[model samples]
Structures are given as structure tokens and as C-alpha cells.
Target: MGSAMNPPSMSEAKPALSRRRGRIQLLLIVLGVVGPMLLATGMYKLQFWVPEGRSYHGELIGNGQTRADLGVQADEQRWQILVTAPKDCAVDCQQLVYLARQIQISLGREAGRASHALAAAQPLSADYAARLDREYPQLQRYPLDAGVFARTTGDKAVPQLWIVDPHGNLVLRYEPNVKGKDLLNDLRHLLKLSNIG
Candidate 1:
């Protein structure tokens, strides 16, 4: 009776302890593999501890729209600073165009990685066309479709600049009044972060 009632012997206890240890080790392995992924997903969904400060000065285009959506063909495989004028290239539009070129020039060693372009809804005035031809030798030109521009930009018909990626994806948009220095900084930041054009 005493033998029958004796506490579990060491030999019998060994297997139970081993099984418990194995279960604990398995649980730890699973946690190590999947813990961070779950935590990251939770943080993204809850917007917890996310940084409030952004480095970009322009409005981010996160709607998955591309240059094609603006009715402009993507011929350049490099990063493009495209100025879009829904109306005639007036004072605001011309200023944005100049800003775009200046920003590209400020890139210095990275200049070849980027190009400046203009998309105008109406034909340029002869004097402006002559000026563009003589002064802006490297500027690319495109015809802007007003109908598509209206659909894409809603009520915003003013001139704006777009930072387009190599894959033709629209990254950011800046108003006509955006400063050249600020735009240069933004483009530099993008070039530094991106491996592609």
C-alpha cells in the first residue's frame, strides 16, 4: 500500500518533466518567429507610436495613380519632374516649369537621374515657345488632355508639379508656389532613399 501511494518516482517524473520542457521550448520558438510580425501589424492598424513629422514637402499621392492617368505618356525611364498646366502656360505655369528645371539642375551629380518636363493643355504662345526652345534646350514637352486632367485633379485646375518615379508612378504633387529650395530638398531626399530612378 505504501509503495502504491508513494509520490511519483524520479524515473516516472523524468518523462513528464521532459514533455513539459519540450512544450515550453516549442511555445518560445513560435513566439520568436511570429511575435514581431503580429506586433508590426497591430501598430500599423492602430497607428500607435508612428512618427508625426514627415520629410516630404509635397502632398503625397497614395491613390496608386500614375502618369498615364494624367493623359501623358511615360517615355522617360528616369525620375521626372513634370509640370502640368491644365490651361495655357501662364505666369503660374511658367514659374512651376522654371522651378522644376532649377530643382533638377540643383541635383548636381544626380542630375542625369532626373529630367524636367511640361504638359500644357493649350498651345504655348509663339514668344514663349521661342523662349523655351532657345533657353530650355533639355526640357521635354507633352500635350495635356484637359478632360483627363479634370477627372484626375477634380476642381484643382491650377498648375502643379509632379514627382514621377521610373515606373511612371506619381509620388508627390506640389503647388505652383512651392519654393525651389524646398522642392530641391524633397527631390534629393527621394533620390537618396530610392535605388531606382
Candidate 2:
């Protein structure tokens, strides 16, 4: 009866303390592994802590669409500034094409990692074709399928420029009136952040 009433011996208490310590260590390990995943899931689902301002000037293509969705057959392995002309390459389209070329050239040392391209729904006029040939020898060209382009873009008729990744994923898109300086800044930021082309 006295033995039962007395405090637990040190030898007996050690195992109990060790078991408690082991349980705490195990709990910590579990939390360390699971905590981040839970937090990330919560943040994503709840859309909390997201900033309102965007670092990029162009509209982001978050739908995971690729250049193929635009109906242009391009196999470029580097980053591309693709100007899409769903109609004839009119003045606005021509300006965007010129801007695309200038943007690539302005990239300076990083220019080799990127290329400029034009995809037109209709063939350029003979005079404009000759001019592009003479003036923009490095310009890559593709034929834009009007039907496919129409399906993809709905009724939007305005020509636009796209920043495509090395893997052909569409990134940012700019309207016809986008400034060259703003586009240049966006490309520089993308190049700085990207490891791939």
C-alpha cells in the first residue's frame, strides 16, 4: 500500500518521459512536413494575401494555352515575340510587327535567346512582302489559319502580340496600341526571371 502511494521511481519515470519526448518529436516532424502544404492549399483556395497590382504591362494568359491554339504552326525553340494578324497586316498590324522586331533587337545581349515572328491570316501585299524581305531579313513568318484563329479568339478582330515561352506556352499578350517602352520593360523582366528561353 505504501509502495503504491509513493512517487514513481526514476528508472520507471525515464521511459514515460522518453515516450512523451518521442511523441512530441514525432508531432513536430509531421507538422513540419504537412504545415506548408496546408498553408499553400488554404492560400490558393481562399485567394488570400494576393497582391492587386501586376508587375507586367501585358495581359497574362493564365489559361495554359499555347501558340498552337492561335492556329500558327511554329516550332521555335526559343522565346518568341509573335505578332498575330487575324486580318490583313494593316497599319496597326505592321506597327506591332515593327515593335516586335525592335523589342527583340533592344534585348541587346539577350537577343539571341529570343526571336520575332509574324503570323498573318492573309498574305502580305507583294510590295510589303518585298519590303519586309529587304528591311527585316531575320523576321520569321507563318500563315495564320483564319478559321482556327477565329474559333480561338471569338469575334476579336484586333491584331495583338504575344510573348511565347521556349516550350510554346503563351505568356503575356499586348494590344495593338501597346507602347514599345512598356513592352521592352515586360520582356526584360521576363528574361531576368526565366531560366529557359
Candidate 3:
């Protein structure tokens, strides 16, 4: 017939059109699900959409050193806040220890997810050590080697603080004079973002 020779009928065209429409709909559905994820990844990697300035409050160590390099066992599944003083527990040293305690407490329900320790340059006086135990029963005490302290902070005589990640990397450092709230803010941010710790 003339119609058969001329072209395909509308009814015959319907299946092809339907196939194309189905493919387009499937493509759109896939893009709807995957496009945002790809965009977010790109934005994060390029730092394009992220807010400017440091997202955290601590002084980043930038050393890339792990706990093993510093002689720690480095086996903790939780995060650790470590304070080291040049000498025995002095006023500032005691204050730093108290700050660590407060920081852990501020974590609230996440408190059990963190640990605290003090590494003294010299052996703490038994009386002072006992007092620390009484006041901060959860704080562990260690004697820090002068070389280790010097290597860590580039100044063996000054009191310093460190934050160790769950993977044992030394990530942040703080001076003895750092505000408690700032340290707490950084810890809270890290814990919230971290999946491993």
C-alpha cells in the first residue's frame, strides 16, 4: 500500500518514542541522585563553596608525625589530649591539666570518646601528683624526655599541649596560655567530623 511505502505509522512510531522517553527519564533520575553528591565532592575538594578561614581553632602541627615517633604506644581507639610541661607541675602546668579535664567534661555524651594525659619534663612531686590524682582521677601522668619535648615543640622549656587523632597522628598543638573554650571548640568540631574516633 502507499501508506506502507510512505513512512511508518504513528502507532508504529509510538514504541520508539516511548523507548526514548523512558531512557530520558532514567537519565534524569540518575542525575538527580548523583549530581548533588558529585557537586559537593568537587566543592569540598576545591574549597569553592566551603567558608573561608580555618574551620578549626587549634594550631595545626603540620609535622605529620605520629605517636610512635614520639614514643607513645599509639594504640588508642579514642582521641587523646596531651599536655607537657618543661618541669614539675607548676601553676601554669596545673592550670593546663585542669583545662584538659574541663575540655573532656565539655564533650558531654562524647566524654568517654576522649582521653587526657600530662607528660612532665621532670618527675612530679609525690604530693603534687597525689593532688592531681585526687582532683583528676582520669588523667594519666608520664615523664617526658627533654629531647622528645624539644623535638615536638622546638622548645623544651615551654609548656605545650597536643591533640592526637584516633589514628595516632599528632594533629594540633597549643600553648599553655590557650583559652579553654577555644580548645574545647576544636575538640568538639573534630569529634563531630571524625568517623574513626
* Top-lDDT candidate index: 2
Model 3: which ten-residue window has the lowest total lDDT? 67-76
Ranking by lDDT: 2, 1, 3
TM-score of each: 0.80, 0.78, 0.70
CA shift at 25, candidate 1, in angstroms? 10
Question: Candidate 1 vs candidate 2: which has greater TM-score?
Answer: 1
Model 1: weakest 10-residue lDDT segment is 2-11
Please give the clash total of every predicted structure, in order.
0, 0, 0
Residue 18, candidate 2: Cα error in Å is: 18
Q: How many clashes does the backbone of model 3 have? A: 0
- Candidate 2, poorest ten consecutive residues by summed lDDT: 2-11
Model 1 C-alpha lDDT per residue in residues 1-197, reported as the tens digit of each score: 87886476867999999999999999999999999889899889998977899989999999999998997875889999999999889999999988888888889999999999999889999999999999999999999888898899895789999999999999999998898888898899999999997
For model 2, what is the error of residue 93's alpha carbon versus the real structure, in angstroms, after optimal superposition? Answer: 0.2
lDDT of each: 0.92, 0.93, 0.81
Ranking by TM-score: 1, 2, 3
Instruction: Kindly list the per-residue Cα lDDT of model 3 for residues 1-197, writing each as its tens digit.
Output: 77667356777899999999999999999999999999999998988878668866778867689765554444677899988776667888888888998899989999999998887768888898889878889887766676765675566576777888988899898888898989998998889889877
Per residue, candidate 2 scores C-alpha lDDT tens digits across 1-197 of 97876467867899999999999999999999999899899889999976799889999998999999999999999999999999999999999989999999999999999999999999899999999999999999999988888888885688999999999999999999999999999999999999997
